[model samples]
Target: MNKKYVLFAILPFALSACQSFPTHLKKNEAMIVETQSPDLLQTLSDYTWIYQSSEKLPPIVLDLDAQKRIFIKTGCNNLMGAWQFDGKQINTAPLAATQMLCPPEFMAQEHTAFQFFNQAQLNASINISNPVHPLLTLENKAGQKITFKGEIKPEAKYKSTGEVVFLEVSPNKKPCPTDNTQQCLQVKQVKYDKQGIQTQIDQSWQVLPVEIQGYQHNTKQSKIIRVKRFNTKPQTATPEYAYIYDMTIEEEVAPQK
Candidate 1:
């Protein structure tokens, strides 16, 4: 192991039986990138790490969410597991994964990912000097090293979990709010109750001059989607509140009668 990498993990008794990693490891934004010594667990949860092994595979996304569950996206099947970091190495429970059949290349890469994250007592190193683009390296006992680069998550960037709101987007576009020549998505607020039943929907459509992250509108079909809205910080000088696409509720094409 490299002497420069200082990993301060808990003892055996400290890491009691639990499906997830220790909650103490999961801290707020303050413990992340703003100190002389950054917390490893906090940084892992706040940033999305991209696998840097092969350029052929659609970048594998390895991230540890606030809940301490390990999530790996191989662009084929998703690999999930709960991990624990002892003072020496990392050990994860038997991984849970989706059984999706993909191309040979993707499957081949997925195999390597599954082996690494599932392996016992793996050595890991992280460097968060550049908050925007941190680097993580994991080495197996066989002397093979896998690297990943980090990108700050939206929730981390905005400093909040943000409000989850639903919207029904129209199939057609309205005139853009600022530019008359451009077109924009016409949307209305959709409300759902605790039972997941429709409660209310805004009757009138409004011009959405801004774009929602991870969303792509189809002119032929109207769709309802769930999204998170966050107040943009003054430093970014972005919109009043930034919208990120969460999931699609429903969609359909109207009969042109």
Candidate 2:
């Protein structure tokens, strides 16, 4: 047997073994793929990242929308910015923040977040060990880290962008139509056109069967509110649609009768 021929034959086997076993990859880093799926943004945008500093403190909310816009809530004022993920890192542009004075504890977290995210490009990692609950982490050059838990966005889970509906809520509650034992919201559907001008409204108020998320009507005031209407999952929900409060369009204290 020729020595050179034996060495050349063994080289191919060694290369194949190396290719089969990529020892360079760390177990924790396996999911941070170099070639991410084409719909990476869609996957990321589906979830909202939340940072809960403590059970007593309010959680910081970070949302990534389809327009490449980042919406952040820091317990006081909202922050808006742009963001991009380049395989190994997440880059956040300098944010445009609303200037509002908040409590010291709230502002302290806000300051920390500003230092972490404002105009910083960070190394990023995601742990999808459990699909039901995902984790996203960002690290700076100084080895400082911020970890956020992920929750599926309402729009993504519902599979619809949701319809915007206007509702006028009466200050008084009435007996529910379905359950006379329970009280219900007195509401009238208000209609609008593409220009957002009022087109029509229900003549009589109706007892609402479902509760509106994020709405707590004051007993002394009537309110006209904007809400996103989404269809509930069939067979699993009592109401066919769920309304989430978007904003209060109008409010007036009801005169004592």
| TM-score of each model, in listed order | 0.73, 0.73
Question: What's the number of clashes in each of the models?
Answer: 0, 0
Q: Encode model 2's per-residue lDDT on 70-167: one tens digit a residue.
A: 77788876666766666666666667676889999888888887778776667878788976668888798789988889988779888889988888
RMSD of each: 11.2, 19.0
Regions of candidate 1 where Cα sits further than 4 Å from its true position: 1-38, 52-57, 233-239, 254-257
User: What TM-score does candidate 1 reach?
Assistant: 0.73
